[model samples]
Target: MLVTFLIITVTFAILTMLPLSRHEAWWIRGLDFPRLQLFLALLFTLALELSLLDLSSKQTWGLVAVALACLVYQAWWIVPYTRIFPREVKAANNSDSRGRIRIITANVLMTNRNAKVLFALIREFQPDILVTLESDLWWQSQLDILETDYPYTIKCPLDNLYGMHVYSRFPMMNSQIEYLVEPDKPSMHALVLLPSGHKVRVHFLHPAPPSPTENNESSERDAELVIIAKSVAETNVPVIVTGDLNDVAWSETTRLFRKISGLLDPRVGRGMFNTFHADYWFLRWPLDHLFHSKHFMLQSIKRLRSFGSDHYALFTELVLTADTNNEHNGLDADADDLAWAKRKTEDQNVDKSAVPQPEKHSVA
Candidate 1:
């Protein structure tokens, strides 16, 4: 048992350190399989400790050593809490004549049937643009009333976990349902016209996580996000990408995406929103995110009431500033991020020929 624990500890320790290495090739990140390593090591460690209560003192010490090592290894993931932006963007003494647009991103669980809660939240927030992840036909039906308030829409409702819906008050130009990595799983990409007639490209995505029920390997998911990073980099307009990215805010891939796309994370200096596993308060991270170009100033960000879903909705109000071109120090796009995006888009195109297609629907 001690030997087994040592092996697991060594494996997880090594995996945790992979992203720390400086590399230009994305496959190098394949070594940094965080979720998998964290899951398996903790699983076996707890199982042994729980079932083998009669172990001798020396064996218990060995378990303690292994457990301490695992905790220390995970400690690498904890970064010092710091503020990213101001406590609030709205000044108390100053009344600026700027328009505020509230954006909401919610992962309405496909299995959650409490549609009334979602309707109530929508009515309360009354966001200018709303994006729903993990939405299927049933979820789409529940949100049908939103169309009455928001005229524009981009719907791709699928039974697959990747189904997404986007509702906007302003007009959408050249919106399309795009499959970034696999068939059936689709993301929403659109050009939205703001109230001021300013155009911004918005992308909503919910890539599959590296779990038993989802894709076992995160390569495809990571690659697709890199593609999004590239897309945002190539766009001339201000952009906002929001969804349950299935990656942590501090993860290497997510960090790389932010750098490559030049998008600002609302949680950087703020507290961790940690909006997942609504049932289990302990096992949650900031899975839902809102990333935008520096041209926009954040007005507010909040985690909404927990709906009958696995995730808590994220609400962000932002004001688009004019001619804002501030550069952030200590930020640069890794060369590997560009390579990963190029390769992933190419690979996805090849797979698209063989990927499954969803049935046509009026709403989604």
Candidate 2:
């Protein structure tokens, strides 16, 4: 038992400590998802070793030291995401003038036909902006009632499971679909005109995940996200990028995205609102995300009840504040980060034609 525990400890620790570079392999990138799990495993292994190991053995002590080091390292990365750390996005003061927009983003698991439960949740939250991923024509028709309350809408229902739609109470300025890395997969890029007349750039995306059914690697997803990051940086405007990102809130790709786009995540220092794998309580992750420019302050974020889908709907309220831009904690992108992002976007296999132009849907 001691021997087996040591083997597992060493293997798990090595896997957890593996560096995630800009390289685009699925296994390497996938390693970023299980920090919390790795941390817990290390704790268990260390406890077993302490009780069963031969105290006078130098080898046993060495194994214990390595396990302790790995646990601390894993915790360093995962701790910021837990309540034990301070929040990255500051709380918002009641902005009665600028307006508070409540948006809900959910991936309805294209195969799951539970529109009734989804609609019921929507009616309960009454979100100002509704974005759904993995939605098909049937899901769109089921949500057609939203057109009445959510006046401005952008819909691209696809059977491929990458379909996306944005329904907003605020009018959308130049709402259009963009196929970043995949030709058939679409992402929404538009300006939402608030009741206060302020325009907020919104990017709703559902990039393909690294799975056997999709791409065997994370290359394409990384490219799609990098391109969006660069575009948002050029605008230097208030923006909200939300969707089932298909990546975790703590992945290196996500970290680079925040740095490049200057968006802030409210999840930092907050409890993990794990939204994926609604079926399994133990094996779950936070695949959906809501990232916004620093001009917005956190109001409240909720992981709503499951609606028979693999993902739980996320409803978040944010207030657009004028003076809070300089106050929030956001990643600062450097030249190295810019170069890395460029390489990810302009990779040899990337089809430039498939990348949608921002002005394609702009009305004269």
Candidate 3:
């Protein structure tokens, strides 16, 4: 039993190391929560190994239980197979003072020089608001044509891959560039004034991944997001927070954010529009997302083409409306989440070199 368990554990670890599980498994082709599945498999393997070492008589039974758990999760993607994907709400039926707002979010790879593809995507969608990540001066120049259409803009172009930008047809108010953690890493925060005189707070974030090359830990990233979530909960205006969150929709941190922010995910009853891993089709997950407050109803959501980047664009349409009832249906952020957020923010202040650096600018 121990040998078998060890073999399985080593195999799993090796698979993860080689990025073999970067995309969805063949059996779960359409499922977008590949990371979640992988983590569950690891947990089961750990439980089996611990049980085998701890219990002599029930070792076989423990192995059997672990094996069963792995098999179930291996086929867990099927749980939502029969579930219907969320469909777009018809524009004719849109009942809101502010018209439908089309938002196109793309994490244009900082090094991807295919400006043509990026421009082509923008032309095809013609979104009302364009949010791009990993943008530097070069990317900003490539997006010059967009300025005429979207007069209001907030730009933060950096080389660290944390730079973000927002371009909108409506005026941008209370706009500011924030460095959540790690100096020079910037996140765009702005308030958009709609044509109807309504204000919508927009938060565009691209935190470092929990990879060896990056933060090596996700505490800072998780905490920064939690703070944003809490702020969303406190704000009175309708808010639309979107970007390459560097986290999955089903993550514990994300769930807490949703709950604390009282935000709605368009992907909840909808399909998982996996946007990352643009180079690999099967290995994609919904890393890019648009979370909105209850003041808006989802109109549509679609995954756009590869914009010469590592991630595909997520195009979403949200109809802004007034939240008359003040009913928030998200999970509540526990004390732990608040504590984490506060600690992370404080940590950022301690590091002198962690000052929020200026973004590389380009006249787009």
Please report the candidate that would top TM-score against the real structure: 2
RMSD of each: 7.3, 2.4, 8.0
lDDT of each: 0.69, 0.82, 0.68
lDDT-wise, the better of 2 and 3 is 2
| Model 1 spans with C-alpha error above 4 angstroms | 1-15, 18-77, 80-98, 323-326, 336-364
In angstroms, give how far residue 63 of model 3 lies from its true place.
4.1
Candidate 2 has what TM-score? 0.93
Candidate 1 structure quality by residue, lDDT tens digits, 3-97: 66657656655665566664424444434434434645566675676566446667666666666566555544433113544331222232232
Q: Give lDDT for model 3.
A: 0.68
Model 2 misplaced stretches (Cα beyond 4 Å)? 19-22, 95-98, 325-328, 348-364
Ranking by TM-score: 2, 3, 1
Colliding residue pairs in candidate 1: 83-269, 84-269, 274-285
lDDT winner, 1 or 3: 1
The sequence of per-residue lDDT tens digits that candidate 3 reaches over residues 1-364 is 5777757865665444433232322222223247545656777676666665555547555555555555555434323322363322222245553656789999988899998987788788878899999888988887866898998898887887876778899877667787766567677777677677666778888877665566655656665676677666666677888998877676555776787678877676466778978998767677898988777776678898776899999998878754433244445666876665566556544332222221111111
lDDT of 2 at 310: 89
Q: What is the per-residue lDDT of model 2 for residues 1-364, given as tens digits with 9 covering 90 to 100?
A: 6678678877976687665454567777778887888888889888888899887988888889989998998887788889989888888867664468889999998998999998898889888999999889988888888898888889999999887888888888877788777789789888777777677788899888877778788878888887777777666557888998888888888989999888888999897799988998877778999998888888899999999998999999998887654454878888988787778777735633443334445453
